[model samples]
Target chain A: MKARVTVTLKNGVLDPQGKAIEGALGALGFDGIGSVRQGKVIDIELGETDKAAAEAKLSDMCEKLLANTVIENYHIDIL
Target chain B: MKARVTVTLKNGVLDPQGKAIEGALGALGFDGIGSVRQGKVIDIELGETDKAAAEAKLSDMCEKLLANTVIENYHIDIL
Candidate 1:
């Protein structure tokens, strides 16, 4: 089994790095680009697990480590 | 129109930040988490633009700014 996990900053979190990327994009002639934000991606391969267990585990992973619940949210796609 | 842009370090790129994150996750008791990689996500809202034009613009943004072409690969999804 495989899971693609994404972690991102919640709305209103100041993102300096994202801003820098946007500035760089505009400078690079990528007009029409309004804003830029950054996040994290984690790919995990879990062997032969039940869907419910996987979901629970994935959420636990996010709450415990993958995301900073205070400022970030996470989603996982299991395959 | 909306697009989500993501930028990530190429494989073999030393990711100290990711390592720190993984360490923090472990400390927080997230076991079974093997590795962690960090990346960037950029969301843009373009008012009534064709997909082709957006693609071109996005590629330019990535090549020149959003991603370091030499080290990162980016993907954009139109919504």
Candidate 2:
């Protein structure tokens, strides 16, 4: 089974990297581009075939190290 | 309008960051986790409300600055 974890900054949290990318986009002539928010995606393949077990493990992984629970929120998708 | 861009390393390309994360997951006790790949997701808000225009601009943005076309592949999604 495969699981994908998406980690993104919480609403209202400041993202300097996103700001920098916004500026860079403007400089590169991408007009009308508004705010940009950056995040991370982790794709994992699991030896375990059970869908439920894989999602639970992926969630645990996110809680432990994949995401900063205080400022970042993560969603797990099983595929 | 909102657009999302996902950037990932091409197959066969070495990803030290992903490797490090994989090792760290093992060290942290995430068992049964197989290969892991890391990527970036950029969420952008466009002042233009036209879905077609926004997606086109995002594609251009990815080509110009958001992705390294040589070693990375990027996908753009309009939401």
Q: Pick the candidate with the highest lDDT.
A: 2
Q: For residues B34-79, what per-residue lDDT tens digits would candidate 2 score against the true structure? A: 8888999999999988778777788888898999999999998888
Off by over 4 Å in 2: none
DockQ of 1: 0.50
Candidate 1 lDDT by residue in tens digits, B1-79: 7888777788898878778877876787656666566777777766537998887777776776667878787888887
Evaluating just chain A, the predictions reach TM-scores of: 0.93, 0.95
Tens digits of per-residue lDDT for model 1 on A12-79?
99988778777776676556666667777876655436877777888887887678899998888885
Residue B35 miss distance in model 2 (angstroms)? 1.1
DockQ, in order, for the candidates? 0.50, 0.87
Question: Which parts of model 1 are misplaced by more than 4 Å?
Answer: B20-29
